[model samples]
Target: MAQEELKSINFMGWRKTIGAISILLLLVSIVSLAVNGLRLGLDFTGGTQIEVGFAEPANLGEIRTLLVEQGLENPTAVYFGSETEVLIRTQGAMQDGALVLIGNRLEALEPGAQIVRVERPAAGQAGLSQVIVLDGVSAAQVRDTDIFDRTYFGNVEFAQVEDGLAVTLENSLDVAYTNRLLTALSEHANTDVELRRSEFVGPQIGEELRDEGGLGMLVALFLVMLYIAFRFQYKFALGAVAALIHDVILVLGFFSLFQLDFDLTVLAAVLAVIGYSLNDTIVVFDRIRENFRLVRRGSPKEVVNFSLTQTLERTLITSLTTLLVLVMLFLFGGELINNFATALIVGVLVGTYSSIYVSANTLLALHIDREDLIPPPKEGEEQEELVP
Candidate 1:
C-alpha cells in the first residue's frame, strides 16, 4: 500500500529564516568559488606525462633527482601505495625531449632495475584563442575569413620529424616531431598496459567538450523549468530554476576554489547533480501543493513550514541512504572514482539543503496564494464538501 501522506506542519512560520538560509547557502557557494579555485585535472590542460613501474621497488627521491638532472626541471613524482609504482608529470615545454632524458636517467640511476618504455599522448593541433563567443550575428559580420557561417577554425601544430608530416589527419598537418614518440592507439588496442592512464586533452577538445556539455546542461535546465512551470505556476517554476542554479553555482564554487579538474566527466557529474537536486525540490513542492489544498486557514509560510517538517524524515532518510553508498565508493573505489564520488557527496548535501531550505522557501517568497492553488468550492466549504 502507498504510504499515507504525513500531516502538514505550519509551513509559513519561519519562512523569512528559511529564505535567509537559502541565501546563506548561496553565499557559502560564492565564497568557495572565490577562495578555493577548482583544480583542473590534466584531462582539460594539455601536457605530456610518463609513468614507469619498476620490478624492484626503488627510491622516490633518487628517481626525482635523476629526473631533475635529465632537464625536467621540477618534476612531480607521486607514489601510488608503493615505491615501485610512480606517476611523473613534466611540462609541455620541450616535453618530447624530457621523455627521452627521463628514460636514459632512470637507466643510469637504477642499473639493475628494469626500465619500462614510456608512453606519450597525442598533441592537439588546434587552439581556442581564435574562437569567439558571439551574440547575434548579422549578415555584415561575415568577412573574407568566413566569420559568420563558420565560427570555429582548426589548425594543427605539427611535430618536427626527420621526415616531414609523419602523422596525418584530414585538413590538419602533423605536429613538428621532437623525440616524443606519441601514442599509437592502433598499435596498442585491447592489450592492457601496467601503467594506468591519465589524459591531458588539448584545448581544442576541451573547448568542444565544454561548449557542447554547457549547451546540453542549459537545454536540460530549460526543459526542467518548462515542465515545472506547466505543472504549477510561473513563479513556482522560476523559484525551482533559481534553486537549481544556486546548487550548480555552489558546486562550481567548490571545484573552482579547490582547483578541481573540470573535465567532461566532472561536467557529467554536475548535470546529474542538477537533476537529482530538482527531483528533491519537486518532491517538496508536490507536498506543499497538496497542503495548500487541504488547509485554507494557515498562511503560505505556515503551510510551507508544516510541509517541510512532515517531509523532513523522508528527505533525510533518502539523503543518508545515498550518502552511505557514496561514502563507501569514495573510501574504497580507488583513485579513478575519487573525484566523481566526491562530487556526488557534495551534491547530495547541497540537494538536501535546496530541497528543505531552498524550494519550500521559494514558494513562500513567491507569495503563492492557496486560493489560486485550491479550486473554489461549489457553494460549500472544504470540510462540508469532503463529508458524505
Candidate 2:
C-alpha cells in the first residue's frame, strides 16, 4: 500500500535531467583536477610544521618577513587558535641548517656563547648530546636571554653538569629542530615565544603515503564492487560502483577547485563518503529488488520510481542529521580540523546526491528488469512461485 502511494510520483521521470547535470559536474571536476590539481598538505608533501605561542598577539606579516629574511623559502604563517598563536609551514627539512643558524645567532648575542655537540655512546642509536658553554658570560646572563625559556626547547631538559650546562635531547632530530626554530624566532622577534609543537615529514615518506593512499582507495572500490555483485547482481554492483566513483571524484574535484589542502584526513573522509553513499545506494537497490519481485503489473521504470519515493524520506532524514553534526564540527572544531570537517561536509552532500541520481540512473541505463532480479524456480518447483 505504501508502494502504491509512492508510485504516484515519477522519480525516474527526471533521470535524463539529473544525468545531464551529473555529467556536467563530473566534467568540470575532472578538468579542474587535471588543471589546478589538489593542494597537497604537509602530510603528503615533505615539510616542517611549527606552532608557537607568543606572550602577546603575534603579527603574521612581521613573522613572515622575518622568516623570509632568514632565508627560509616559501614560509607560510597563519594564526593557529588565537591571535597569540601562530602555525608556520615550510618546504623541505631545515633542521640541520636551522641549528647552525641558531648557533651562530647565539654566539652573536653573547660574545662567548657556544653550543657544543657531544656524540652519543651507541653507534646505531640516533641524536646527539648538546651543551652550552658560557665561556665569557655567567649562567645568569644566559638565563636572562629570551632563548633560555624551557618551552623554547621541546622534550629537552637543561641541567648544570660539572663542565657546563648540559642539555639532554630526546626524540632525536625533532627536539633539536624545534629548539633551533624557537631560538631563531625568539632572537628575531625579540619576544617570549613558546614552542607549542613541531612536525617534520620527509619527502620520500610523503610520496609513499600519497601513492599508498591512492592505491588503498582503488582497492576499496574494487572490493566494494565485488561485494555488491555477490550480494545482489552484476547490474547492481556496476551501478553502486559507478555512484561511489562519482562521489569520490566529485569530492576530490571540490578540493582541487577550491585549492584546499588534501591531507590524510581528507583522504579518510573521502573513503567514509564512499561507504556512506554505498549504504544509501544499497538501501534503495534493496527496495527496488523487493518491489521487482512483489509488485505486479508495473514496468521497470515505474518500479524504480516507486522504490525511490518509498526510501526518499529515510535517505533525507539520515543525511540531514549527519550533516548537522558535520556543520557544527566545521564551525567550532578549530583550525587543526577545519579541513577535515570541510571534506566530510562536502562528501556527505555529494554522496547523498550520487546515491539518489547517479546510482539509480545507472541501473535504468543498464536496462534493469524484473527478470534480472527474480531468481529462476528450482528444478521440479512450481512456476507460479516465480510469477510477479
Candidate 3:
C-alpha cells in the first residue's frame, strides 16, 4: 500500500496569534512561580518518614489523627505499596528527649513492659553499624516485623539471638521511641502494628538537594545550547534553546499555580521534558535546513511553513503516543508517581506547542535564510566553483 502525501497547511499564517498566546502564557507562568513558588515535598524539605504495617488494611484518616494527637505537626499519611502499609511524613526532626518521653508514656500504659536495647554490628553487612534488641517484647507483639521493615532492612534477618528479640537497625534511631509508637498503634486498633522503617532527613541536606537540582537544570540547558550551535547554526541553536526554556517555564508555572508537590521525581520529570522538547525542536530545525537548500523560490517564512507541514504528522503522532502513556501513569501509577506523571503531561503538551511555534517564530524573527546554513568553501576550492 502507498502512503498518502500530506498537503501543506500554511502553519506560519497564524504565527502572530500563536506568538501572542505563547508570550501571554509565559508571562503568567513566570508570575505564578515568583508569587506562589513550588510546594516542596519531604525529599526537598527535610523531615521524618515513618512506615508502619497493620495486620489489616489501614485507615489513613485515623492514622493521621493519631499522629496529630501524638504531637507530630502536619502529619501526612498515605498508603505505600499496599493498603495494609502506610507511610507517614512530618516536617520536623525527632527531638533529643523524644524517646525518653515516649518510654515514660508507654510505661504508664503498660506497667512492667520494659524497653531494653543491646547494640551490635549487623551480621554479614559491615556497612550497617547498629542493631537494637527489645528485651521483653513477645513475638506476637512484634508480629510481621520483618515484612514491615523490608524497605529499609533489605535482606537482613531478625531473630531471637539471645533472650531478647534482635532486630537490626538500618539507622541509629532510639529503640524505645519505635516500640512506644508501635504499642500505641496496636492498642488503638487492637491489631498487631509493626514499625517498618523510620528515617530522618535534615533541613540542611534538603536545601543542598534543592540548590543542586536548580544548578543541574541550568547546566543541562547550557550544554544543550552548545550542542545545537555546533550541529546547526547559531540562529537554530538560539531558537531551540528558546523553545526549551519556554517548555520548562510553563511546566514549572503549572506546578506552582496548582501548588503541586514538587519533589525529586518531579524534578526528574522536568529534566526529561527538556530533553523531549529539544528532540522535537531539533527535528523541525533539521527539516528546515534541508528545505532551505532544496526549495529555490520561497521566502524564509514560506520555507518554514513547508518544512513544518512535512513533519506535522510525525510530530503529532509522537506526542500523542507519549501523552497516552503519561495520562495512564497519572491516573493509575499511584500516589508516589502522580506528581511525576503530571509534570511530564504538562511538559509534553507545552513542548509540542513550543517546538512548533516558539522555535519557528524565533527563526523568522532572527531573519534566518539559506545563506546562514550554507557551508564555507574548502581552503583550496574556488568560490566560483561552489553551487549557490
TM-score of 1: 0.62
User: Which tens-of-lDDT digit does each residue in 212-299 have in candidate 1?
Assistant: 8879989998999999988977777987888888788877877776666565567778898998889888888888788888866766
Model 3 ranges with Cα > 4 A deviation: 1-7, 96-184, 187-190, 383-388
Ranking by lDDT: 3, 2, 1
Residues 266-338, candidate 3, lDDT per residue (tens digit)?
Answer: 9999999999999999999999999888877777888898889888899999999999999999888877789
lDDT of 2 at 237: 96
Model 2 agreement with the true structure over 1-388: per-residue lDDT tens digits: 3434444467778989989999999999999999999989878888888889988887788888877765454677888879889998877666544455556667777876666654342354244344443333445655656444446444454566566665554444445556656777787778889978878889899999999999999999999999999999999999999999999999999999999888899988988898899999999999989988888778888888888888899999999999999999988876667888998898889988888788989999999998898786788577667677
Error in Å for residue 134 of model 2: 30
Q: Which lDDT value does model 1 have at 7?
A: 46
What's the count of clashing pairs in each model shown?
Answer: 39, 0, 0
Ordering by TM-score = 3, 2, 1
Candidates 1 and 3 compared by TM-score, better number: 3
lDDT of each: 0.61, 0.79, 0.80
Let me know the TM-score candidate 2 reaches against the reference structure: 0.73
All-Cα superposition RMSD per candidate: 14.7, 8.4, 10.0
